[model samples]
Target: MRTTDLQLASALGAWRRPGVALARALADAVGGAALDGRLRVGSPLPAERRAAAALGVSRGTLTAALDILRVEGWVDTRHGSGSTLRLPPEAAMRLAPVSAVGEDGAIDLRSAVPAAPHTAYQQALLRAAERSGPVLAESGETGPGLPALRSLIAGRYTEEGLVTRPEQILITSGARAALALLTAHLRPRAAAVEIPAYPAVLAGFRASGTRLAGFRVAADGWDLDQLHDAFRAAAGGVAYLVPDFQNPTGALMPDAARRTVARLAERYRVTVMADETMRDLDLRPAPSPLERIPRAVLVGSAAKTVWGGLRVGWIRGTAALVGELACHPLCEPLSAAPTQQLVAAELLRDPARVLDHRRTALRRQRDHLSGLLAGDSRWRFTVPPGGLALWLRLTDVRSDVVAAQSSAYGLELSPGQSFAADATCAHHLRLPYTSPITTLDRVAAVLDAACGGQGQGPRVPGPGR
Candidate 1:
């Protein structure tokens, strides 16, 4: 993919800074873009002259910046052809922070995934092994998903007041895959998504070349007027929503907002894709939005509730839509591993015990982390009713700089801009409470030092600062 000068400039938001070398800042911006998957590997960059013009920088400065990128192996420059982006080994690991362990046993707070229920998981695995014979005896080809697992998931939705059928479910490897498949099948020209949403969602839509129309999800909750405008503008497109315990911010869309979204979606002829991955982590009771937006295609996953290792997720839509997705070329005929499906099904059969255990732990951790953050006046946040992370607004610090400096303190932080559709939310940061209370206490200390300028480390100034 060839990145346009305009796009590159947009990605290099606020590269110019006081007391910072322009060339180095430009290089850092490029590296940041590469690390964030914005400037993808092998992406051809615009010519140096054009890029410099776009950035309002001189050609000499651009050349020096390119030299830095080349030295850092973040870009490969050729005499005839232009420079192309490269993903350094360390940057590659940073991109997959969820699975990557930090050096010197650093604390990793980049991912919001929860810890698995060990005893319940062990029991589920044993039960799956015991029940494997019947599944193995069959051809082992499930078109949409394992029927038993689909039935279990559909039954759970039904119990939640949403009438669902097994036929309406198409299981996938995980929620991410489910969403990718939906986007591929829908192939909408534009998509309406919540600003400061899940990073993976934004990256996925951008990768698919879909124009995004973002609606800000404030700290309180969704603004129905803004949501209605976004829907009306993106009419005949698609809207991806995470109304139940929205990621990052953790704001739960009220029942009234859900109904308004349903009505607007219908009025504007928009296809609504509701992500319910965080629904099970509810610290407060809220009605399922699916009941209000019956036409919306819902996505669910066991990764959040039961275990991240399960990798079992499903899409719930009209039976016809399910059939279409099942037959879609992009859709893999076979679902996740049979063993995983069996384990997920076993866990789902009686999930209350396991879910309750997880919810209890998460609630305690959330409160503990919130209490810790409340001590500092510089940090202001609303304690979300549910969700794995807290979206914090830093009063006098830039989240990007703080996150960049946190590495020196052995803390891996996810800056807020990663979750934005554009280069906004620079003052925000997301800290997950998934870690143990002791670890969160340590995290708070590291965050305080990092934000308070107590550490001696190379700090990248915020854009235009």
Candidate 2:
């Protein structure tokens, strides 16, 4: 779908700020719009001279802006048809954060979960173990959650500008569990899920009998129109969104779009579930407040930030709603293990350390993975600002096919097709760089071979390993 001039103008509201370079601003505005779903991927952008004139800038500036988008994978430029707003894929967009380790025999590059900062975790665990002994003996099917952890979780959100109370929070086994509780409680007839979503989330919605209407999320962001349209099409039901550093794609929902969506949700009696599971892994300052929105539920977790093994995730909403949700049969008496709670609480006590350690460790791993795949032209690694893995774009191939072949090469990779709501994203791959740097080298080689030397080789089927 080619973006109309008026559409582009609206998305680029004030493409030119006083001191900001016109070219740079244009690129950011367009990229931001694409990332948030206001602009559709593959939508044709205005011609250089025409766009420049429309935005009251010189054609040279527009050309430079397009170059920026091209380099960033926001748009694809062709000689005759001009540039198009696109979410083709990204540098590391193909990677998914997985827990697979090479020690088990497979060079698991299939997932993008962060490598737990061992030293910090070891220290935190020691503290938790010491504290858990006393806390574990007296728990009596603790309702809502471990009180201290819930308070801590609530406090964490309070600090982030979201008003949350322990009473308003319900701790579950994991993010999936919390989501499952929400789906069960709301029991919407239909819902809209932003695609390239976490697989388990999709599963949760389906298991609860909610028909999912697909909405597209690009490497840049989401198309708000698709989001709003999906909501209306779904009769203003529930909308499940990963607004912060979304999994697989690494696109963060902008603040402006959040406001608009919040209004739309209220207007349509829609329930928006914002999953902030990766919010803690963000590499930069937040573009918007992670505050509670009206008629919405906020899901957060320490699984990604602290340790995935510690199944601690929560849902924050009005007391009435949370109370209702807690009664759902799906919401069992969840006493998230005492030790895990203690470890989480201890870790949460020093939010700065968790943030710093995650940022440093993930950044290092991202750089390591990028360096390993840097020479592979067929795979473009866009160092995401935050998340467990990189979203990679395959030059010309089906990700599912690539994934199947990669297994024979001893690489456990999750194909991009697994992340999309349908088959529209088959040309991508998710590579979670959770393994050690040394292990990543082996992963790159396996990928290179599986791709058939620059990804054009014949598909190699395994002989039943």
TM-score of each: 0.74, 0.72
Q: For residues 78-190, could you state the per-residue lDDT of candidate 1 as single tens digits?
A: 88988999965434322122332232357777888765666677878898999899889977666798889999998988888888999999989889989999999889888
Off by over 4 Å in 1: 1-104, 285-292, 453-465
TM-score of 1: 0.74
lDDT of 2 by residue, 299-396 (tens): 88877776677687788888888788777776764436556677778877886755665576567667766765665667675777778788888886
Give Cα distance to truth, residue 308, candidate 2, Å.
1.2
Give me the displacement of residue 162 in model 1, in angstroms: 1.1
Give the Å error, residue 1, model 1. 63
- Identify the candidate with maximal lDDT: 1
TM-score quality measure for candidate 2: 0.72
